[model samples]
Target chain A: MSHVYERVALIGLGLIAGSMGLAMKAHGLAGEVVGTARSKDTRDVAVGLGLCDRVTETAAEAAKDADLVVLAVPVGAMGAIAAEIAPHLKPGATVTDVGSVKKHVVEAVSPHLPDTVHFVPGHPLAGTEHSGPHAGFATLFENRWCLLITDAGCEAGAVANLRALWEGMGANVEEMDADHHDLVLAVTSHTPHLIAYTMVGVADDLRRVTDSEVIKYSAAGFRDFTRIAASDPTMWRDVFLTNKEATLEILGRFTEELFALQRAIRTGDGEQLFDYFTRTRAIRRGIIEAGQDTEAPDFGRGTSRK
Target chain B: MSHVYERVALIGLGLIAGSMGLAMKAHGLAGEVVGTARSKDTRDVAVGLGLCDRVTETAAEAAKDADLVVLAVPVGAMGAIAAEIAPHLKPGATVTDVGSVKKHVVEAVSPHLPDTVHFVPGHPLAGTEHSGPHAGFATLFENRWCLLITDAGCEAGAVANLRALWEGMGANVEEMDADHHDLVLAVTSHTPHLIAYTMVGVADDLRRVTDSEVIKYSAAGFRDFTRIAASDPTMWRDVFLTNKEATLEILGRFTEELFALQRAIRTGDGEQLFDYFTRTRAIRRGIIEAGQDTEAPDFGRGTSRK
Candidate 1:
């Protein structure tokens, strides 16, 4: 791969940004990579890990001469960072974000960016329970979908270039409207995460079952819930807050369906539970067929980890 | 390891039974293992896969002359199978089960067995989404928990021998009351599986998001739910039906907690969501520390499968 951006500035040094840094270096996707984090410890760690060619104390210093600036901070912090770096952005620079919620990020950061800079909101549908700079690896985004939100007046060339960079780093990019992206993500990611968090919370709060017992017997199904619930709390909190309507909507549907199933269980309606479980099995087949996950047993966790 | 039981009979050759067969064979925990399934096709598959030394046509035939009889059928089927095999069980032999729900199994199987036989109910806290004889592996129970239920009248020697067999097959054995085991499982497994099935059902029913989109973008979180929801419909349906009281209790608690979190999301209460998520992260840490799961990124799926 060749350089798609002469200088790339990463505004936040967390899992996503650190992953992008390592992936870019591995694939030679950028000529120079510069990064900044709010904490000195994070910046020092990034520098020590050689995640970027240069580590700056301020976002402004990192974005001063960058052709592509990535706002990889929490969704709530996008506006402040964008305002700080707006005046320092180079002419015709492209500013993209990797926030989970796209519309809120566009609303938060768009007004602060200069008109010369292209604001393209993006979200890479890839992550693990782990976070932080050390949690990233070179192939974090391999074969994962990166959804890009393009406004009507956004430059096609800018979008194309940004997509090329993500592709070079091993992601498949697709374009969607901001509202649709938020809604779709609420269905696919946000609500599911919230539900996982809630389930794990319920397990934790059960007084009848001891905590050690829950942990000991978790390998059956609750272990998966704990993994998702273990995700970065601040990032997920912002996700639910920023994507409130969509998350609530999906939650509403989830509650209704769950209530119906609960009724079935209470009523001893084996047919209803069987039909519902059988239908969901087909969706799992669809996911395996789409290559989003493995068909290997136990989510491939038992075989490999053991 | 030497043989703990001279002859072991596994009734209902599914994932758990088949796995027990393989693990027992691998560790030489039983002198001879015989299995029987309701379906001729299942028995044929067990024989073809070498999951057992002999595949019998009836539960009675499998139970005859067996020193250890394992009822590995679904909880709902235990009563009928027990009645069929009770007449054939050897004197002084130990009869146990691998049912997910134990209180019901004890009630169903204990009465049918003669006083000479020691009836011990058990539940192995291990399985994958896949089912059938083909899904069996020798290491499925390695490092996983197997809860054994022993009443006051149960023989200590019988319990100790059963524990030795499980330990020899690479499982950690624990003892708990039948009702407590059911309730704990309701919290750890049954309710989680039901919620996963409901979530996947909601995703499939959503009109706005295409099935392709859900499957393609599932890597974020929903993929885990799908893997869990893909579990055997018959087994899960039986679990929900047989363990109705405990499962419903957990479902009631789950719904209450979920509604609270849903309200928090609607009211823009980031603090509540953050606290709940943060607390749940501690449980995940406990599971990892308990060695029930790995802290490897992406559930260790990406590194091993890719």
Candidate 2:
């Protein structure tokens, strides 16, 4: 692979940014990778890990002269970081983001970016429960979807170049409208995460079952929820807060469906429950066929030890 | 390892019973293992896989002269199978089960058993989404819990022998009251399964996000739910039907807490969402510390292909 950008600045060196640094270096996709984080500890760790060619103390310093600038901070912090680095952005440079909530991120950061720079909001549809500078792996985005938002005013060449960078890093790239992306993610990621968090919370409050027992016997089904609920709280908080309408919309649908299923259980409607479960099983098959998940038993959880 | 029973019979050759057969044979825990399933296809598959030493046509024929009989069918079918096999049970034989809902199984199967036989209800808190005879593996129950309900009138030697057999199959055994076991499972397994099914169903029903998109982008949290939702529909249907009261109770609590979190989201209460999410993360850490799940990213989903 060859360099897609002369220099790339990654603001907020967390999992996505750190992984981008490692993956870009591994694939030789960027000429020079410069990164900055708000936390000294994160910056120190990134420097120690050699994640970036240059570790700067500020987003502005990192953005200076960079051909591509990635706002890899939490969604809530995107606007401030965008403003901080706006004046320093090189002319004709492309600025993108790795925020989970794309609509709010575009709303948050687009105004702060100069008209000379291409602002293409992007979200990589991949993550591990683990976070921080040390939690990233080079192959994290491999075979994952990275959706880019090409709102009006975004240059076609800049979007294509950004897409090539992500594809070179081993992601399948697609373009989506910012609002549609948020709604789709609300169904696919945000609402499910809230549900997982809520279920784990409910289990925690159940005194009769005991937390130790919940932990010990979690392999049955609840353990999957725990894995999801273990995601970064601050990141998820920003996700729900920023994508409020879509997340709540999906959650409301979830609750309505949940009540119907609860009534089925309460009324001993085996056929209703059976039909609903059977339909969901077909979706699982679709996912496996799509290569999004493994068909091995228990999501291959038993054998998934590193 | 010495034989725990001279002859063992497994009725309904599904995942659990088939696994028990393979595990027992692997450990030399039974002198002879016989199994029977309602479907001819299942029986043929069991014989083809060499899952049992003998494949019988009927539950009674499999139960005949066997020192241990395991009713491994769905919870709703336990009563009928018990009635069918009760007449042929050998004297002093230990009659056990591997049903998910114990109280209902005990209620359904106990009355049909003769007084000369010891009826000890057991539930192995382990399984995968896969079903049928071909889904069994020798290590399915390894390091998992198998709860035995030793109610009054159950012989101590029978309980011990059953526990020893499970131990031989690499399961940690525990004794609990049937009612408490049902309630605990409702909180841990049944309700979680229902929630997963409902979420998957809701995703399926969403018109805005095409099914292809949902499947393609499912890796972010939704894939886990799909795996859980892919569990055998008939078995889950029976689980909910049999364990109605407890499942409904947990679902009630789940909805109550979900509403609170929903309200927090609606009101932009980031603190409430953050604290709840943080508390749930501690539980996830506890589960990892207790060795119930992997702390690896994505539940080590990428590396677990073997």
Candidate 3:
């Protein structure tokens, strides 16, 4: 692909940003990529890994002379980074973010940016439990959906160019409003992550079942929860805190349904339990049919880690 | 490895039973394997796939003169199958099961067994969401745990031979009491499956987020839950019904912990959420270190289902 952005500024040298930098390089979608992180160690490591053409000590320095600036920090940090880079962003630059919670990110970063910059908030719905600069790969976004929040008067040209960059990185881009994006993500991502964290916590707290036993027998099913539960704590904390309402709403519904199943188990209502389980099976089929996940058993996991 | 049993009779031609058949055949752990299922269709498929040397029309016929009888039916069906085969079991034979709930299986099947046969109830901590005869594979139990309930007056030779068969099939065999096994599994498997089913059902029931939306965005994290939720409904229903107390106990504890986290989200308590998440990360690392799971992003699942 041809250069979608002449100069790209990645304001966080974390998993998403590192992956973006590598992907853009692999696809030749960006003429130059510069990255910055609060931690000097992170910046040094990112530079050593060649995640960017060069590393900057500050977000403002990275944003200078950039055609596109990506706010890839934790959601809570977006506002500060945006404020720092506001005066440095080149005129008519397209600014986008890769925060998990779109509404909060837009709200946090938009007020700090100047009118000269086109703000097009985006979230690539792709990640792994691993974090930091070293955890990224070029194919991290392959066949994944990247939702772009374009409700903030983003220019057509800016949005199209950003979409092209994501597509060049192997993601299918879709436009979604911020509010709907938050709610959809609550159902599909935020709520599920919270539940996974909760389940793992409960197992850890149980006195009768030792932690070693939990880890040894995790292949039974609980290990799946742990993979997501082990995600970057600070990033997830920001997600739950910012997207509180939608997550709580979804959790309410989840608890109610869970209570109903619990009652069925207690009452030995086999038919109710059977019917509920049978209905849920259809959704898994739909996911496989949609090509959102593999049909391989246990996600095609081998006994050994790669 | 030499044959552990001269003739092994498998009383149910399902995922666990068929898998055992194939694994035993692969390792030469059983001289001849005979199978039977309530459904003629399942028996036909098992025979067509060569899951057994031959499938009998009745449990008694399969059990006749068999050195090892495996009751691989649902937990709720174990008692009836044990009763049916008790009269036909050979003198000095060994009988085992592959139920998920150990205490319940012991209670359900022990009373029906004759004194001449050694009863060693076992539960293999392995399976896929897919079920029926065709879903079985020779490596399903590879490097997985197989817990044997030796509380019954099982002879040492019988237990040793059963352990050898599981070992030959590439499983790590361990001995655990019935009650302890049930409780441990309630935390690791049963409760997780129930929670997954509940979350998927909630997503399906929500009118605001269409089903297609959930499926399309499942790679965000919800897809992991759906894979386990798609498990055999009948088998899960039997599990919940038979293992009611331990499952209910774990469910209570899970809800308590979940409510605490939910309140943290409600109150915007980032510290509590962050700490809880951080603590859970250790468990995942322990699982990977213990070789219970893969460290690959997304369980090493390819975008395509294989």
Candidate 4:
């Protein structure tokens, strides 16, 4: 593919930014990809791994003269990075973020960005449990949804260009309202992650069933929870803290539904449990049909794949 | 892998029993495998797939003259099947089961068995979301745990032979007390499945977030829960109904831990959230170290496999 941006600055060279760099380079979608991280070690690693064309010591240096700037830091850290790079961003440059919770990111970064630069918050709905520059792969965003907050009143050309960049990097781009995106993600990602973390914690705290046993026999089902719970703690912490209202609201609904299921088990209501479980199967089918997940058994773990 | 049993009878032609049939045949572990299912269509499928050497119309017919009779039906149906096959079971035959909840299976199946027969309940801690005879694979139990309840006072030879059969089918066998097995599974499998089902149900219930959006964007962690939730409804209902006390206990602890984390989010206690999440990561590492799950990203989905 041809270059979508003359230069792209990635602030916070973690999984998303690293993947962006690799994917952009693989597709020839950016003329130059400059990256910076809070830690010198991460920046050095990114540089060593060729995750960026060049490494910058500061977000300002990276943002300077870049046609596109991506804030890929923790949601809680977005505002500070935005402010640090605000003055350096080229005029008419498009600035977007790859944060899990978009409303919080928009609230955190938009005010800090100068009016000269167009701010369009974006979140790619794809990831592995692994993090860091080393964990990223060029195809990470392939066939994944990258939702852009076009309702933020950015110029049409800016939004379209940003969308093209994402699409060129192998993502399907769609525009979503920031608040709606947060709420939807709270239901889809945030709440599920918290539940996985909580379940893993409870298993660890259990003395009767030793941790070894939990680990050894995890293939029964619990292993899936651990995979999700194993995601980056700092990024997840920011997610829950910044997306508080929506996550808590979803969690409340989750607990209510959980209590009802618990009651069904306690009361020996087999039909209720059966019906509830059967209904949920349709959603799984929908996901498989949507090509979001594989239908292979056990997520095709240990299975031959091509 | 010489014949572990002269003739084996599988009393339910679902995933587990069908897998046992294929695995046994693949390893030459049984001279003949006869399978029976309640539905005629399932019996035909099992026979057509060569999951069994022969298909029997009734549990009694399959149990007759078999050296090992495996009660592989849903937990709730074990009692009825055991009672149905009790009269026809061969003298000195080993009666084992592959049920998730061991205590209930023991209670449901042991009473009807003749004193001449040995009752040993077993559970293979391996499966996929898929069900039915068609879902079975010869390697389904490879490197997975098969817990046997030898504490039920079955003959030593019978227990050893059962263990050998599971080993022949590529499972690592362990002896566990029936009650402890129930509790461990409650913490590991039953509760996780319930939570997943409930989360998926809640997502489906939300009218505001269209189902299409939820399905389309599910790869962001929600898809894992959907896979778990998509598991066979009838089997899960039976699991919860039979393992009620232990499941409820784990669910109680889970809710307690979840509430604490929820409070942390509400109060902006990032430290607690981060610490809890970090601690949970250790379990995932342990699972990987224990060889229970692959370290491949996203369970190695869409990746080339050797």
CAPRI category for model 4:
medium
Candidate 4: which stretches are off by over 4 Å? A207-211, A303-306, B303-306
- TM-scores, in order shown? 0.97, 0.98, 0.98, 0.98
**After superposition, candidate 3 runs with Cα above 4 Å error:** A303-306, B303-306
Model 4 earns a TM-score of 0.98
Candidate 4 interface RMSD (Å): 2.1
Winner by DockQ between candidate 2 and candidate 1:
1
Candidate 4 on A1-306: residue-level lDDT in tens?
778899999999988999999889988999999999999999999999889999989999999999999999989999999989998888999999999988888887888888898999999988889998888878888888899988646799999899999898788999979888988898889999999999999999873446478777888889999999999999999999999999999999999999999999989999999999999999999888988888988877773321
| Chain B TM-scores of the candidates | 0.96, 0.97, 0.97, 0.97
Model 2, range A1-306, lDDT digits (tens) per residue?
Answer: 779998999898889999999999989999999999997899999989878987899999999999999999889999999999999889999999999999898888988888889898999998899899998778988899999998666788999999999999889999989988998899899999999998898899873456478777888898889889999999999999999999988998999999898888888999999999989988888888889887778767673211
What C-alpha lDDT does candidate 1 achieve relative to the native structure?
0.89
Query: Please, what are the lDDT tens digits per residue for candidate 3 over residues B138-219?
Result: 9988899999998555699999999999999889999989888888898899999999999999998873445478788888
> What clash pairs does model 1 have?
none
Candidate 2: deviation at residue B72, Å?
A: 0.4
On residues A1-306, what C-alpha lDDT tens digit does candidate 3 reach at each position?
789999999999899999999999999999999999999999999999889999988889999999999999999999998999999889999999999998888888989989998999999999988999998888888889999988656699999999999999999999989888888889889999998998898888873346478888989889999998989999999999999988999999999999999999988999999999999988888889998888877777764211
lDDT of 1 at B4: 99
Identify the runs in model 2 with alpha carbons over 4 angstroms from their true place.
Answer: A207-211, A303-306, B207-211, B303-306
Chain A TM-score relative to the true structure, per candidate: 0.97, 0.97, 0.97, 0.97
Model 2, A106: alpha-carbon shift in Å?
A: 0.9
